[model samples]
Target: MSGGEAYVFAAYLALFVAVLGWLVIHAFKIARLSRELAELVELARRRDGKAPAPDAAEARVAGQ
Candidate 1:
């Protein structure tokens, strides 16, 4: 292949690698957030000494 064709192929491969890396990093972030939310849910359950409610926390915040 010509030099120009080789350069084009290399550019495309680099772009593909970058996109895949970004997807992996984003997935890791999502997993971390999910773990944090679960911890918060557990803390809330203990704080109120009852089962967690979907709206109860929001209502408490609004009332404050």
Candidate 2:
């Protein structure tokens, strides 16, 4: 390949890597958020002195 073509390829590769990195970061964020949400749900159940209820939890999450 010509030098100019090589540079163009490198630029596209760099862009792809950057986008991949961003997706990975967001994936981690989503995981963290889910964990935090579950913790909060459990805390609420304890404070109310109720046993864990799956349907109620699903409805709460859906309402939000």
- The TM-score measured for candidate 1 stands at 0.67
TM-score of each: 0.67, 0.74
lDDT of 1 by residue, 1-64 (tens): 9999999999999999999999999989876766666668668787989887746654554354
RMSD of each: 6.0, 2.6
TM-score of 2: 0.74
Per-candidate local distance difference test: 0.77, 0.83
Best candidate, lDDT-wise? 2
Error of 1 at 58 (Å): 20
Q: Which stretches of candidate 2 lie over 4 Å from their true place?
A: 53-64
Q: Say what the RMSD of model 1 is.
A: 6.0
Off by over 4 Å in 1: 1-4, 51-64
Q: Candidate 2: give the clashing pairs.
A: none
